[model samples]
Target: MSLISILTPEIKKAVTLLFDANIDTIEFQATRREFEGDITMVVFPLLKVIKGNPVELGNKIGTYLVENVTEVQAYNVVSGFLNIVISADYYLDFFNDVKADKQFGMVEPNPDDKAVMVEYSSPNTNKPLHLGHVRNNLLGYSVAEIIKASGKKVYKTQIINDRGIHICKSMLAWQKFGNGETPESAGLKGDKIVGNYYVKFDQAYKGEISELIATGLSEDDAKKQAPLILEAQQMLLDWEAGKPEVISLWKTMNQWVYDGFATTYENMGVDFDSYYYESNTYLLGKEVVQMGLEKGIFEKDPDGSVWIDLTEDGLDRKIVLRSDGTAVYMTQDIGTAIQRVKDFPDVGGMVYTVGNEQDYHFKVLFLILKKLGFDWSTNLFHLSYGMVDLPSGKMKSREGTVVDADDLMNEMMQTAQTISEDLGKLDGYSEDEKTTLYRTIGLGALKYYILKVDPKKRILFNPEESVDFAGNTGPFIQYTYARIQSIIRKADFDFASKTFSAGEITLHEKEKELIKVLALYPEVIQNAAVNHSPALIANYTYDLVKEYNSFYQTVPILGSDDENAKMFRVQLSKKVGETIASAFKLLGISVPNRM
Candidate 1:
């Protein structure tokens, strides 16, 4: 059991016995720095059941905890807070027990527990993934790992938007402008090769629209009447009708995009257990619409369109099926979601990692599902996140200004190389090792900077700022981890298997603080899983690294004259590095054994 678990009930018992009051929940927080304790109990909440002076109340409980709990060595009362100083022996015992644990603070999922499905990187095949998709993929992958660590089975998945008018636009451009150029002939990634055509289509579309407007047409009419766009629209219709030539072309182009996306996902270190293509699931929710109509969950308009009225539920009306009997995006989504449940019967919930622009859409979709009577709908969550902006501004794919995922990753590696060379940390390393370390540090900086912030808040990503080896950045923590590794390497003794017996030696203040921070790992992981936030895990890791650094600077490890103290500190350093690696793994980041 954890220290918090063992103390919660005891603290409650102390409160009950001393104040003669019943409390349902115990409020405990880390002791403030200015306070002389390791954990604190808030006395303000107890006033409702036991009215008394706040400071006096704190003193009474503080006295009770020291007398009754074996771990509690001392206590202090400040204002309405009772700070309890736990014995150093307790921390040493806890650390000793966990030092050799390879899977420390992580739990295994029980077979009986319902599995969770996380959906991310729902990219349209029209263009290669951009900066926004990086954040989405990283967030999804990390959250899935965290959920698994918290003792629930998790499945990672994505939906490919392979069929739409947008896709036809790219196809039309490639056909009209190209002399049948292929990704192989062009020596480009299939997605990037196809993505160039997407941009070409937009440029041609704008030129055609401008020409039509010059000939006395309104901008909206010009856009609608443009020959290229009309052809693309016809192509969508033909593709839906399964025209032989169009279907063949569609398959070829989508294959190129798929091959291209596979490379990107591999490089980004994200994966999916299953996938849903819009082409396969586009017609799915039509039958569901009929079910909704029969159950009165949806109403048929005079034009035969199906819609769910949610105005009374504080949302606007939303259409499920059009009057022409064609399914909308929402219909396809409904069908896709249902299909997933059928595919993975154990899945009890889903997390959709979508941008904040779709906030209203998901709200409507979740509500519609509840109205349609799906039991799993209750567990649905929309992990809405804000846009990732650059220092310059927002990105536009059609304008060819969006940051390509592959190119951005390469740029990060280059930047890392430059910075590392300047820092002169790669002495005596071979070229290949240097390359690997550069990519590791670069990607680490990128992932950590993005994941450390709250998902709902917009981020202004600066690669240079992120890679700096100080001030809560990824490379900063990575450097600290590497420093610990260097210390472990210098120690000739076996620190891995040999640690001091618990309570055998006295503890320094910094050592106690480090242990306290280490003890919070399991709780941090649990909280990160429950709230679906990688930011929690990211910041917790930063805090742990900071505490370890403080201990490293103030305390002597191998230089200690006392052999017991030297061995114990080296063992402590190894544990810190292990914990760092563990936390970084959950974020899809790797820590180098050497800098």
Candidate 2:
């Protein structure tokens, strides 16, 4: 049980006995640094039910805890704060019990509980995955893992936007650009080749608009009348109508993009449990719209368009079906959500990991589902996050100015290599080992740099700063893990086989502090899962590393002459390393044994 769980009822008993009153809850905080205690209880809140000075109440509770609680070694009151020092045995016992469990912080999913589905990286096939997609994938993947670690069954999914006018533009551009070129012939990944055509389509369409404008046509007229754009629009109609030739080309091109995406996902260390396609799901919500209309959840205009008026709920009217009887994006999303629950019957909740630009769209989507009388809609969450910008500024995919995900991964690896060589820490390593280490450090820097920030905040990512060996960077933490590994290697004795009695050794102040931080891992994982924030786990690992390093510098481990103390310190260091590895695994980042 947690210290809070164990102390709460006892403290309540003390309050009832001393003041003849009852209290429902206890307020606890980390003991202040200047205070000589491990945990603190705020005595001020008890004033609501009892009449007494805060300090006097605190002293009475402190005396009670010291007399009645075995874990309470001593206590002091600083104004309204009752700081309690826990026994050294409590810290030692906790370390010994959890030291050997590889999955110490993670909980196994209970079969009886409902599962959660997380959607992320729902990229359009018209372009390659870029920096924005990078953030989306990392956030979604990490959140899914964290939820699973918190004991829920999690499913990771993404809906590939394979059909749209934007896709038709790329197809038309490829068809018109002369002799047909395949991915093999173009010496490019399928997605990159397809993305090139997307950019080409935009360039050609712009050139046509400029020419028409020069001939005195209005810019808006030129844009609508651009021959290339007109052809692309017709192509979308043809694809929708199931023209054999258009369908064949669409299948071929989308397959290429899928093949390229598979490679990118593998390199990025993210995966999906299932996939959805927009082409199959786009027309799904029409029947649902009819059901909503019959149920009075929706209204139809005289023009025969359908909408849901959410003005009372602080939102405007949102169209589900147009006057032309075509479904909007919102309609597709509604159907997709329902379809997923059908696919995974046990799913009780879903988290949509999309950028903040569509915050209002999700609001309407979830509210509409609730109005439609879906029970699971109450569990829906939109994991809305801000955009990631480079120091160079915002990116436009059509203009070919976006930071490509694959290219960025390569740059990170290169950055890692440069920094690793400069640090002169690669002695006795083979070329292949160096390559693997560089990738580990590079990707670690990338994932940690992005995940370390709160999901709702915009990130200005700097590659050079992220790879630094000091400060709160990934390499720094990885280096600390590696340092622990080295200490373990030099121990010469079997630290794992030796067990020290909790009463046999008095813990050092640093050792006690380290154990306190270690005790927080389980709670950290649970909190990260609850808040849907990987930033919690990321920062917690950083803090643990900081605490371990402080303990390392102040205490003797393998160097200590006292064998019992030395063995205990080495065992503590090993546990810290294992915890680091386990935490990084949740973030989809790998750590090296030697760095």
Model 1 Cα lDDT, one tens digit per residue, 264-332: 999898999999888899899899999999999999999999999999999988999999999999998
Cα RMSD (angstroms) for every candidate in the order listed = 1.1, 0.9
Q: What does the lDDT read for residue 341 in candidate 1?
A: 95
TM per prediction: 0.98, 0.99
The whole-model C-alpha lDDT of candidate 2 against the native structure comes to: 0.95
lDDT of each: 0.91, 0.95
Clashes of each: 0, 0
